[model samples]
Target: MGPPALYALLMLAVPLATIFAYTFWTQDGLTIDRTLTFSNYREAFNDPLYRQLMLRSVWIAGAVTLATVMTAFPIAYFVSFHVPQRRKALWIFLITIPFWTSYLIRVFLWKVILGYNGVLNTTLLGLGIIDEPLSFILYNANAVVITLAHAFAPFAILPIFVALEKIDRSLLEASRDLGETHLTTFLRVTLPLAMPGIVAAALIVFIPTIGDYVTPRLVGGPDGLMIANMIQTQYLRLNDAPMGATLAVLAMAIVAVISALVFLASRLTARIWA
Candidate 1:
């Protein structure tokens, strides 16, 4: 590997090793007792609060992944099947325009739109649909899902679009020649062939959303707090690095299992396609 590669490995290795070591150690009054022990992991698994938050994070991440993939698939399908090839570039470009803005700005804008007396509430008020702002729309797990779905939309879209684009046009024609309807052809041919992309999209959205700190911090009040927020609290507010490291390791292990399942699903898709 080149110098940049070496540097990258160096940066990745050190912090990872440090965190792993911390998981084995215990925290004591603003100082870490560096002697190794399994107590952190023991406490993590035994604590109901830790278990609840971790599961909640994974569940919210799953919801975000599903929402983003469902929303993106239609747009990707439109671009791949309905739109003219010449206009496809413009459509993809438009999808990416949001990327030009900062993620923090996007989250803040969502807060504004979803907040009490924000656009959604004010519109509802002006239209006489409701006399008061809907308090349920923001500062909850629902808000986190909405924000993360919006944030990860493009990541889902691009992979799914690529998957749809690479599909052989002949397969659709072959199905049609056999007297298949458009819907049937899509269901039997296009959709199955596109499974790998959908899986990829799901993984992309699922992995990062679980680890996201900012969205949960902003939109997720007490109800919306995810595992990452808890880990952040442990490290920064609670001054418990060992516990934080333990949570981080546990998160990665869960995500690793998720990734393996997705990979197996993708391979199964490929075999079915073949």
Candidate 2:
């Protein structure tokens, strides 16, 4: 009754509690020791490999977030400002069409597009622009970033569009009335007003992309493997549930810190704009 008790209990509290307890347990061979200990957490921090992967995941997620927002903003602006009101629904519908397909399908499409003999390379090869198929685009952090940015594009666009749409037309007119150019009005008024949505989109895209296991697995070669992949290996393959839980909790903590920083930055931006 109080804020969907069953939902929170079954989904959040229960699973989190299990993971927390698991973090305090240790594994040896095929057996798990239920005795509570800090060894998992200890190993997580002391292990240099975990630290590097965590940092790399954060970096790739940041790249995806930046790329998604920058690309989404202009599309959102156009939908809010340039499109006829009657056709706005149509544009939004088209944006949502991709959602009807499977997420894996979209990712696989990117894989094919970026494959050695995939669409981009073949086209370039035919066009005589490149000497050989580009080798660096498909199986690295860049591919993971590109795949994630595309996967989360709609998430970024919707919030930003909502923010831009909510802006008062009168404010723009007033700016023009005071002799401000379009660019000046945009920088001075539009962008600042839309910071909340931009922030929302950034957090939304960044958090999940960092923990994204599949994108990195299919597209990311050994070098592009993220922390999530390691977590999965511990849980599924390595039979080390405690270590996996430790990595998971540590990842959540890092994401929490990053999210907090973003929230503080947004608050400061709001204060300055005010």
Predicted structure with the largest TM-score when compared to the true one? 2
Error of 1 at 127 (Å): 2.6
Off by over 4 Å in 2: none
Best by lDDT: 2
The residue-by-residue lDDT of candidate 2 on 1-274, one tens digit each, is 9769988999999999999889999997888899879988888999999999999999999999999999999999999999999999999999888899999999999999999999999999999999999989999988999899999999999999999999999999999999999999998899998998999999999999889999999999987899999999999999899999999999999999999999999999888877
Over 4 Å off in model 1, which ranges? 2-5, 269-274
lDDT of 1 by residue, 137-170 (tens): 8999999999999999999999999999999999
- Per-model CA lDDT versus the true structure: 0.93, 0.94
lDDT of 1: 0.93
> Cα deviation in Å at residue 205, candidate 2?
0.6
